[model samples]
Target: MKSYKDLSKEELLQLQAALEAEYEDAKSKGLNLDMSRGKPAASQFDMEMDIMDVLNSSSDYKTAAGMDCRNYGLVDGIPEAKKLMADMMGVANADNVIVCGNASLSIMYDTISRSMTHGVLGSTPWCKLGKVKFLCPAPGYDRHFSVTEHFGIEMITVPMTPQGPDMDIVEKLVSEDEAVKGIWCVPKYSNPQGYSYSEETVKRFAALKPAAKDFRIFWDNAYVVHHLYEEKQDHILDILAECEKAGNPHIVYEFCSTSKVSFAGAGIAAIASSKENLDDMRKSMTMQTIGYDKINQLRHVRYFKDFDGIEAHMKKHAQIIRPKFEAVLKVLECELSGLEIAQWTEPKGGYFISFEALNGCAKKIVAKCKEAGVVLTGAGATFPYGKDPGDSNIRLAPTFPTPEELRAATDLFVLCVKLVSVEMLLAQQA
Candidate 1:
């Protein structure tokens, strides 16, 4: 296979003609496949149908601590659910963990809202401050940026390496800027790239001497227990434990949810941090509402039983989604390999595979796929402000569709990539 860069104008024109014909034939199939979000398939949902039966009209509604889950008293959460979430997040104990509403995004949004109205701990409120900024690692979660941007906080783009965010830039920016209030991190099996922070990256995060006392690492361990390969799992240094060791105990607010593990919107979410940080958040939480849905929390506790049970359940999910991932990868390797015009991350875990097309090729590729009856996440969605400066990265979600659907979608995707790459190269040639 010749690299697309090495092809002559005539060869490029010939290849483009062939790929465009494939695209047209694909469009005629009336396919309406979507590879946008990392949504679990309907077939996978059938395996967890028994979760509904875990609780019934006659079942015991009381937790292990003797509190009736049917009631609304436990504002934080029942002990067992906390234990499960804590264990899943790799934290030491359930003491500092708070099980909240179904979405971790809600918890995340509220965390920022609290900082806006009232300061973190004793620091001045972000709303009262002159300027607030955040270090955003590129090819990062879009929602994380949405949260910060919603608060009108300035976002600084931090480059992401295979290990983690560029820490040299992170350390300098954090230590010098008092208004650099926070940094968003997925730590384990990160969104899109599934790249876990190395031990050193975690240590540097823990050891940072931020100029602002309110600065925190929004460590979203959303995929801590989400591993695709049992033998080749990614390990991250526990930020909570490491922060304590570094005397920066209040430097992180870790979040996790069973959104992917169990139900998406109906899942239980949680946040873990130091006692002081938890206490401060609890003070604000007390005023937010009477209490969260403990009944649903109880359902999760009863369904999974323990972290080990949750791990076993995820393995079943992996079995269902892994082939879809492999199908996309196989097509990429077959069609795009040695093209010298693209690169991508092949993660062992997490729900997405991140691909990088040639400069200015991402939007064209996504538009091309959509025009052919396939929908994909917008090209720049993985970066801050929904703008990938190079217009190169595209997030491929292989979890939502069946193997056949995925194969068809990948076929279209690669066809689009080839067509777009040739056009891009031709534009450069002219």
Candidate 2:
């Protein structure tokens, strides 16, 4: 297939007309499909049905340490659950991990709120500061950006490399600007791109001497255990360990949850950090509520006894989601390869395949896809404040759609991309 930019203006116009006709026909079919969020499909839940059985009426409601889970008292989660979560995060000590409610996103939000109001370990509260900024790697998770934006924090877009965020930029920004309070990172199998940080990148992050004393790395290892290829599995350095080794133990707060592992909204979540960080958060937690859902915490521990069990369960998830990823990738490969009008990331494990269309064509392609009955994540969501400067990156979430649905949606998606690219080319020619 010839790259659209190489075509003559007449040829581009002719191609755009044909693509428009095809798009209209696709619209007439009224095919409503959503590839918006990184949610697991209905079929993917079948394996998790046994999770319900793990805590039936016949089961013991007490923890292995004999703490009755029926009554709430462990504000930091039950001991067994802490250990299980720590194991998941590769932390040698469970004392550093605080198991929380169903979603790690909630844990992350609360941490940010706490910092905004109370500050991190006695630094000036961000609310009192004149300005607070966060370094957001472009093609990053939207929710992370949303949280920072919600707090009225300025977000600086840092470009991402295959190994991770451009750390050289990250280091310099944090070092020079006291206003740069923190950065949002998805260290392993990152959102959209699925690129894990290289060992050196992790080391640099650990050794960063931020201008702001309160600066912290909001590390969301949401897909740490999510692997699509056994052979191509990505390994990321343990952030907490690296920080501790670098004598910056309080510089990072890492989060993970079983939201994707077992159930979307009902799985257990956790935060791993230094004991001092946990202690500071605990003071606020005491005021937040009597306790989080300890029963559910015990349920997760009882179900996935250790890292091995969790690994086994995730392998099952891999078996299910791997094909959906492949289905979408296959369509992208066959339709857009060598087009030179676009580029996309072929992720090995994460929930999305990040596609970069021709500059200025992303929003139009997304609109065209929506008109043709396929809904994508809005073009700029992967960036801070819902703005993609070049209007290029588009996140494709394949996990939520069935193989057949994904194929059809992707077919329309590529068609829209072609249509939009041709139109864009024609406009440039004019």
Q: List the global CA lDDT of all models.
A: 0.91, 0.91
List the lowest-lDDT window of 10 residues for candidate 1: 65-74
lDDT of 1 at 122: 85
Candidate 1: where is the Cα deviation over 4 Å? Answer: none
Off by over 4 Å in 2: none
Worst 10 residues of 2 by lDDT: 43-52
Model 1 per-residue lDDT tens digits across residues 1-430:
7899899999999988898888889889998999889898888788998999998999999998799887768889999999999999898989989999999989999999999989999888889988999999989998999999999999999999889999999999999999999999988878889899999999999999999999999998888887888899999988999999999999999999999999887899999999999999989888987788888998899999999999999999989877887788888998889989888889989988989999999999999899888999998988888889999999999999888888889988988888999999999999
> Which residue pairs overlap in candidate 1's backbone?
none
Cα RMSD (Å) per model?
0.9, 1.0
lDDT of 2 by residue, 1-430 (tens): 8877788988887887888888888889889899999999897788788878888887889877788888969999999989988988888889999988999999999999999999999999999999999999988999999999999999999999999999889999999999999999998888999888999999999999999999999999999899998889999888899999999999999999999998998999999999999999999999998789998887787788888999999988999999888888888889999889888888889898999999999999999888778899999999998989999999999998888888889999999989888888888877
User: How far off is residue 286 in model 1, in Å?
Assistant: 1.0
* TM accuracy, model 2: 0.98
